[model samples]
Target: MQIQLEFPAALATVLGMRGLLIDGGGTLRETFRRIADEYPKLGLHLFDESGGLREHVLCFWNGTNTRWLPSLDVAMTEGDELVIMQAASGG
Candidate 1:
């Protein structure tokens, strides 16, 4: 499966800028792992020691945020767009 990855900001060096077209498969976690491999610097900005999402980023599959999903176990379909955005902060 192919997923469209959109980066919201100037993130880690591996992410470069703009978007990325990546292979998608299995679970959402798997997709993240693939991205991490493609962009090594994203690992620290997104994953924890337990291998889960870090506290500062939110991911959306299609138009739905994964936080509302059954779990991060969501799978990808061909041509699905995966948007990775930096968490909004500041009060």
Candidate 2:
């Protein structure tokens, strides 16, 4: 399915764009894998050395935190939105 992807300003600054449309898989994992394959630089910021989401990274599926969801394997359909941002923590 085709989905819309939104990146945080910081990440977009680095990538030079804020959002795009891409063909994604049924599951989030596969979508992320396709993203990593298509944009390794952006993937570096999203995934850690172990290929897992970094501690500070947050993923939202249609405004709901993926962490709160039952699984990242949740099926996605066309027009779904995936938002990525880094958790903010500072004084």
Candidate 3:
């Protein structure tokens, strides 16, 4: 399936583009792997040294945080949007 990726300007600067479309995977993990393969630099900001998602990074699948989903193994559908953003915090 084709997945639409959206990112903030800061990240877009890092990625050298505003967004992208990629052949998604059966599972979110697989999608991430594909993204890593296509954009290793962007992947660095998304994953930690141990290959875990960075604490500041949030991935929203179809407007829902996958972390609250029953599983990250959720399958992708055509036109599914995966939005990547950094968490915000302030006093």
The most accurate candidate by TM-score is 3
Candidate 1 lDDT tens digits, 18-67: 78778888878789888877776766677778667777778788988877
Candidate scoring better on TM-score of 1 and 3: 3
Model 2 earns a TM-score of 0.89
How many steric overlaps are in each model, in order? 0, 0, 0
lDDT of 3: 0.85
Instruction: List TM-score per model, in order.
Output: 0.81, 0.89, 0.90
- Give lDDT tens digits, candidate 3, residues 1-91: 7999988888878868978999986888888888887889888888888666788888999999867888777788899999988889996
Ranking by TM-score: 3, 2, 1
Q: State which candidate, 1 or 2, has the greater lDDT.
A: 2
Model 3 stretches astray by more than 4 angstroms: none
- CA lDDT of each prediction against the hidden true structure: 0.77, 0.85, 0.85
Off by over 4 Å in 2: none
Residue 76, candidate 3: alpha-carbon lDDT: 86
**Regions of model 1 farther than 4 Å from truth:** none
